[model samples]
Target: MAEQQRLLGGRYLLKEKVGTGGMATVFRAQDQVLNRAVAVKIMLPQYAGDPTFAARFKQEAQAAAALQSPYIVGVYDWGKDGDTYYIVMELLHGTDLKSGVRSHGALDPKKVAQIGSQICGALSIAHKHEIIHRDIKPQNIMVQPDGNIKVMDFGIARAKNSHLTQDNNVLGTAHYVSPEQTRGQELGPTSDIYSLGVVMYECATGRVPFDGDDAISVALKQVNELPVPPSQINANVDGDLERIILKCMEKDPANRFQTADELRQVLNSYLAGRAVDVPEPTRVIAGMAGAGGTEAMRMGDKTQTMVRPTAPGDTASNPVIRPNNQINTSSYDNEKHGMGKGKIAAIAIAIVAFVAIAIFAVSGFLNGGDQKSVPNLLGMGQEAAVASIKSSGFEPGNVNQSYNDQYSEGQVCEQTPDGGKTAAAGSKIDIVISKGPKPIDQVEVPDLSNASDLDEAKKIIENAGLTVGSTTQEANDADEGKIVDQSPKAGEKVDKGSKVDIVVSSGPETDSVPGVVGKTESDATNTLSNAGFSVNVESGGTSDTYAKGYVMKQSPTGTAKKGSTVTIYISEGKDTSSDEVDVDSLGLTGMTAEDAEEAIANAGLKYDPRQQSSSSVEVGNVIKYSPGGKQPAGTVIILYISTGPSE
Candidate 1:
C-alpha cells in the first residue's frame, strides 16, 4: 500500500524499489542524515506479523553491524513503525560477484585462488564471533569494480550465544548448501566453508558443483555425489587448485576446513605457488545428539518484544557480571492493559506510594504501562545504549562517550540508573560505554575483472574494508601491473579480515632467428628479422645472372642466429654491347680462309665461343650481316669466323 513517502525517522527517504527477497522488499534511498545513498529493506506484510522471522531478520542486521571488513555489506538501521518494519543498509555501486562470473565465464585457476583466499579471510571474522552463516551462495557475494570481494546477507543465521532454533529443516540455497544442511544435521563454521568451496568451484568451472531436477536432487548430491574436478571442465584450472576445491566439497562437514581461518591459510599457500594442507574429510554419525531436557521457551505476549531468557550467560565463563544491576526479566500481560485508564491508574498510584518519597513517581497505572524495565547500559556504546534504552520504556538522552578503565572503549560503561530501578515515564537515561569501539561494517570487496593495476586493486580492497595480501604474476596481453586474478572467487559472502590475493600480468616474451633458401630474399629478411636477424645489400656480378635486386645469394642460406649479419648479392642490369664491332672488314671475296679470320679478328668480334656450323661464310669469316639479336654496347660479336665448329 502506498503511503506518505516521508523520510524514515526523518533520516532516509525511500526513492525507488530495487529488489525483493523471501520476506523483504529492498529499495534505494537517500540517507538525509548521512547525506549518502543507502539501501532500505522493508518487511512485507506477509512476514511482518511473523514474530520468528521478524526477530531473525532484526538479529541478522544487528549482528552484521558488529563486524567491520571490506568483504561485508554494512547495516545502518532496523525498526518498526505501526505495521512497517524496515532496515537501512549500505548502497553498493558495483556489480555483484555472480555478475562477474557470468560475464567472464570460468576464471583461471590463479584467479579463482585469488578470490577464494579473500572469502576465507572474511569468514574468519564471523567464525571468531561464533556466527555461522547458514546461507553461503554466489548471489550473496559482490565483486567491486576495483577487484575486491564482498559477502552479503546474514539474516536467518545464528550466533553461538543466540537461543534460536536449530531443529528446523530449512536448507540453504540448493546449489551451495552443505551436506549436513541437507541432512538436517547440526551445522558449524565448516558448513559455510563447504558452501564457499562450492562457490569457488563454480567460479573456476562456470558451473556449481551440484545440479539436479529439484532441490532434493541437488541436496542429495551434496550429501552423496562427488563433483567432477574443476580442471576437467575448465582447462585453465590448476591441478592443486582443483584439489583444494574438491576438499571443500567433502560430503562430511568435518572433512572440510573447520574454520574460515583454516581455509584462508590453505588458499594462501596455493596462491603463493606452494603446496597446501588438505583437510581430512568429515565423518557423520546419525542421531549423535542425546535426548535431554531442553530449556523451556516462554511465549511472551504480543506487546512484549523481549522473550523469556533461557538462563543468562553460562556463569562459569561470565564471572564478571556488572554488579551494579541487570534486570533479566520484565514479563507483560495484555488483558489488563485493554481496560480503561481509571482501573489501571488507581492501581499504579497505589503502587507508586510504596516507593520512598524522595524519588519522583510516574502516574501511569498498572494498565501495563510500565511493563518494560530499562536494561543496564553501563559499558555499552552510545549507539548500542540508545538501541537498548529506546527498546525499553525510556528515551535515550544526549549520549556522550568518555574513556573508561573498567570497560572497553565505546562500551556502555555506566548508566544513570541501575537496572530494576523504578523511574518516571519518559525519563532520559544517560549511559557510557568503553571507547574501544569496534567498526561496524563488513563489506566484501568487488570482483575485479582482471589485474587492473596493483594500486587500483588495493584501493578497491581497502575501500571495501579489507587489507591486501600476497601478489603473483605470469605472462599476459593485459597492460603491465594489471591484476588478472583474486581469491574469494567473487561473491562469496564473508565478514572482515578476509585477505584478498592479487595476481598481475607481466607482458610477453621476445627473440630472433634463421632459415631461408627455398624462401625469397624478402621472405628471408622477414624471417631473419622475426628471429632477430639483421640485413645488408650488395651487387653480385655483371652477368646479372639472377633477376635484378633478387638475392643472388645470402652469406648464410640458413641458421641466421640472433644478432647475425648476412649480406645478399643483387643484380645490376646488363653489362655488355656490340657497338665496337667492325662491320667493314672486307677481305678479298674468298681469297684465303686464313686472311678472312685475321680480318674478322680486327672487328673486335670474337669467334663463336660455343661452336656451331654456319652455311653463310663459306668456310671463311665474312658472313652476311644478320644481326638478328641486338645486345647492349661492347658486345662480343662472333662473326662465325670459319673456325666455328659444332660443340
Candidate 2:
C-alpha cells in the first residue's frame, strides 16, 4: 500500500493507479518540480528485483527517450528509487488500439492505413538508430483523442549492437510474430513491418489473422499457415490496402518491405490515391518456403524454376537428375537419348585440353604466363589493397562497399576467390570494402549558464546540436528569464541530440511562510514543502481550542528565504493538572452525548451528564461542557446534551 504514494527521485508523486500490464503498472502522477501531470510506469516487483530484467528495462527506456518523434509516445524521465524502477512518460488521455477495436469493430481501411503509416514513421526513426520494436500489436498502439496514432512499448526492442534473443524463447506476441521470429532466426526492421501488417489486417477486418486456444498453436500458424486476407473477412477492405498488408506479412523477411520508411512511402501513396507498386502475391511451390507456407493457395498458374546450390560435401561423379522427380532439374533426358560415341569422345577431349591449359596457365609452366598467389588484403585500406593486388599480378575489380560497425571506413572486408588463391597475371579480383560504423552525431555542449536571455540560450544550444529540455524557474539574484544554471554543464561533451536542463532566474526568492494554523501536522508539513520551504515539527504547549496533532503555531511565519527551514508547533490538547489526565484528554464537542459519556468513562473520568434544551444544537448531541481544560484523572464537571429545539 505504501507504494501507492511513494515519491520517486523526490520529484514524481505517484497517485492512483490507472493501468496495469504484464510488465508494469502505470499511475497518474504529478511531477512536483515541474508542477505538471505525467504518467509513471513502474516495473512490477518481479522484474524490478531481477538485475537482468531491470537493466534491459532501463536500456529500452533510455533508447525510447533518445528518440524524438510525434508519432511515438514520449519518454520524459526514468530512474530507480530504492527497489522500484519507474519511467515517466507523457500522460496520454486516449484509448489503446485494442480498446478502440473493441468499442468500434473494423475501422475504415483508409484510417487503418493512416494509423499504420504513422506507426511506420515512428519505426523509421527507431530503425535508423538500429533499434527494432520486437513487439508490435494493437495493444501497444495508442490512438489519441484527435485520431492520431502513437506507437508504444519498446520494452523488448534490442539494438543492433546487442546479441540476438534467447534461442527458442521468442519475445513477442505470437499472433503478430514474423516467421523468422518464430524460427529463432536473426531479426531486422522487416520483422517489425510484418507485425504492423498483422496490426493493419486486424484493424481492417476486426480480428487477428491467426488465432488458437493457446500461444503455441497461434505461433505455429504464424510460422506455417497462410492468413485469410482482410478483404475476404471484410469485403469493404480495399484491394490496394489488402495488397500492402499481404506484402508486409510476407513469410520471407527478404520479401517484405525492406524498411519502415519504404512501407510508409507505400502507405502515403495509397492514401493519396496514386498508383502504388505493390508486388503480386507470391506462390509457395512444393519443397520451398514462401511467405504463407507450402499449403498456401497459388496466386498464379505460372510455374517458377528455382536453381539451388549443391549441399555442402555433396559428392557425385557428375551432375545427374534423380528419378523421384521431386526437384526441378533440366527437363531433357540426356542419358536416355545419348550422343554418338565419336561425339562424346570429342567433347571429352575438349574438356581435357581446357583443364590442361588452365593448370599450365596457373603454374606459369607454359606460354611464358606469370601466375602468383593473391596477397592478404583484408583489414587494409582500399587503396593499399588495390596496390597490393596490382603488385601481386592481379588487378582490383569492382569494389562493393557496405556499412560495417566493426571495420573502419574504406578497409577491405572481403575479396572474391579469397587471399592466397592462385591467379594469372592481370586477372581481375573483386573486393568488398567497409564504409565504417554508422555516423552518430556527437557535439560539445555549449555553456548557457551565463546567457542572459533564455530564448537566446536555447537558440545557441540548438546551434550546438543539443535540445533545450525542461526549464525550471528558481529564485535567484540573476535577471528573470535568464539562465541561472544548466545540466551537463557548459563545455561538457555529449551526444548531438542530448537534452540539457536549465534553471531560469525568477528573481530573488522573497517567500513568506504560509499560515498553517489549525491544519493537521501532516497537512502543514506538506504545505510548507510545496511552498519551497523545509519544515521541522515541534511539540507546542497545550491549547484549549486546537485539537491534538493539529498545528498550533509556526516560527518565522511572515517572511523567509525560499527553501528555508520552518518550525511548526503541534497542539497537545489543554494542559491538565495531572500527567494521566493530560494523556487521557478528549475533544467531545462534535460527539453525541452518549459517545461523550462513553469516552469520559474510558478515560477514567466520572460521567456526569445532563439534558438541555437548545435551539441550535441537534437532539441528544453535546451542547456545553465545564472545565474545558484537562482536569484530574478522576475529576469530571457538568456535561450538557441538547433535547431538540426549545419550545
Report clash pairs, candidate 2: 251-291
Q: In model 2, which regions exceed 4 Å deviation?
A: 163-168, 285-647
**Predictions: Cα RMSD each:** 26.9, 23.1
lDDT of 2 by residue, 218-322 (tens): 998887776666766797886678789988988778888999989987886676455788865544534444434432332245433322222332222113343
Give candidate 1 misplaced runs (Cα > 4 Å): 1-4, 279-647
Among all windows of 10 consecutive residues in model 2, the one with the lowest summed lDDT is 309-318
| lDDT of candidate model 1 versus the reference | 0.66
How does candidate 2 score on lDDT? 0.79
- Residues 289-372 of candidate 1 have per-residue lDDT tens digits of 111101111233211111111223222222433222222122222345666555476689877776743333343343346544
TM-score for each prediction?
0.45, 0.47
